[model samples]
Target: MLPSVVLMSALAVGALGANTTYTYTFPAGFNIGLVKSDELSSWCQGQRNECPSICKGSTKQNTCEPSTLKFNCVCADGSVPDVSPYIQTVPFYVCEATYGQCIDAHPNDAEGQRACKAAATCGSKNASAEDTTMSSTTTAASTTLAMATSTSASQTTSSVAAASATTNAAALFGLEGYSTGLMAGAMFFAARLFL
Candidate 1:
């Protein structure tokens, strides 16, 4: 029984250590507007212009090109502006704004207009529901198991696993690297306790 518990704890810790990457793609109709060079540049420039104000002491330059539209304001220190608040509110303002411009520019193009409209509505959809659900499920299970074990070691291990699961889930939306060192430290401590 002790060996099984150790094995299970080790496996949980291993699972938490796995590196995962998440990519967020614009909704179907939104891509059409985003693909236009002029619109893309306009959006990119808007984000670039806001970088200095958003990410103080960061190099304010056009970091985004037509091919890659990364909207985050990356600082010289390799940190990015915390846009999580805006994400909760505006979601993809760049896509929405550019799509509006695309629709205006192609007034007579019905398909393009429809696509822009569809893109505009994407902000209302809960795209991260699946990721959130998965994270929550994992956290709940880990917590339950930890409570059942009724040991500080098990509880710590479970908390780390839950945190890792949550962080991995958040990574899908491009919010990463914030708690990496902290998680590693916690994992090391938990492992020591287990041993």
Candidate 2:
């Protein structure tokens, strides 16, 4: 009688779909195809470091990783409630990637700004500005220092390049000798076996 009651309760829960797992599968080549497809657009376009803002209401329920390359968005519980209705049929990966790119490009938070500015792409805009902007007084004082150091800097660069070239040549020769020794040993063994 107890087993019958437990079986009936299990059936009731299954009928309600309470514990059902939902998965969203993307079509093959969707990620690569997204490069050419302009149909789906991110809401955070032109906004830097704003990927996390997309999860305002569900901040605790979802994870947002903003990157200079792309923004990633996913449910913390790994259960994504169908956002298809809101996304104009865009795949979740596309949405996240787009958001991450925009967020990484336009960081608003201090840490994000530091990271974005440090990135190679953003460095030109952020670091180059500082490099190009020299105060007139400081530039005047450094003029003599630059003249004194230019020769040494050139010599240092030349020596470093020569060292790098020598290291590469030595590595190549070592690898070639190792390969030749192995082949010679294999051929000698084969000759003895056949004889």
Candidate 3:
């Protein structure tokens, strides 16, 4: 008697998902699908971390994990209530991917704004007038510093290039190999490697 009731519940949940285990059946020959919704819930909850990373967000469908025996849709409260096939119409603010059907919708709108706000995001500066002016000054200062750094780097590079050219000229002069420790090292390495 208890088993039959459990099977009935599975059937009911399976109706919502063509591939969902929420609604199921007790076909005489085989039991291809036998899931207790409550049990499924626990199983799904355990696999929550592995759900699609794309589902991360405030307006997220935080229901059963993708690992459910059969759950392709999320409930409003973030539950995987797979009464889908049995459900003829959609409730407000839900992405219609239940009942073996998949439909993506903005979890945002007039009614959804409250939820969105609760899921706050770090946004651009909503500064006061004085703060805005201060920010502009900081930005200007940063630009100036960047420019100064660029100029300093260019100057250093040019000086280094010029010094390198001078050293190359000394090298070409026949006394070229005498100026630095590198010359001695190169000669040693060359003799060792070649010989």
For this target, which candidate reaches the highest lDDT against the unseen true structure?
A: 1
User: What would the TM-scores of all predictions be?
Assistant: 0.31, 0.26, 0.25
lDDT of 3 by residue, 52-82 (tens): 2222222124344322233333432243443
- Model 3 segments beyond 4 Å from truth? 1-127, 175-195
Per residue, candidate 1 scores C-alpha lDDT tens digits across 1-195 of: 111000011111232463222223443333443356775666566556555544444552325444445444444544444432232222255546557776877779999788676656423433245446767899999998977777877788899999999888888545346567668889999999999
The lowest-lDDT stretch of 10 consecutive residues in candidate 2 is 1-10
The candidate that wins on TM-score is 1
How high is the lDDT of residue 39 in model 3? 45
Candidate 3, residue 60: the lDDT equals 28
Write down the lDDT that model 2 would get.
Answer: 0.41
Alpha-carbon runs more than 4 Å astray in model 2: 1-141, 147-151
Off by over 4 Å in 1: 1-24, 33-35, 60-62, 84-93, 97-195
The number of clashing residue pairs in each candidate reads 0, 5, 15
- Residues 24-131, model 2: lDDT tens digits: 343322233334333323322322222223332232232222221122333333233443223322333344444455455566677765543343121012222233
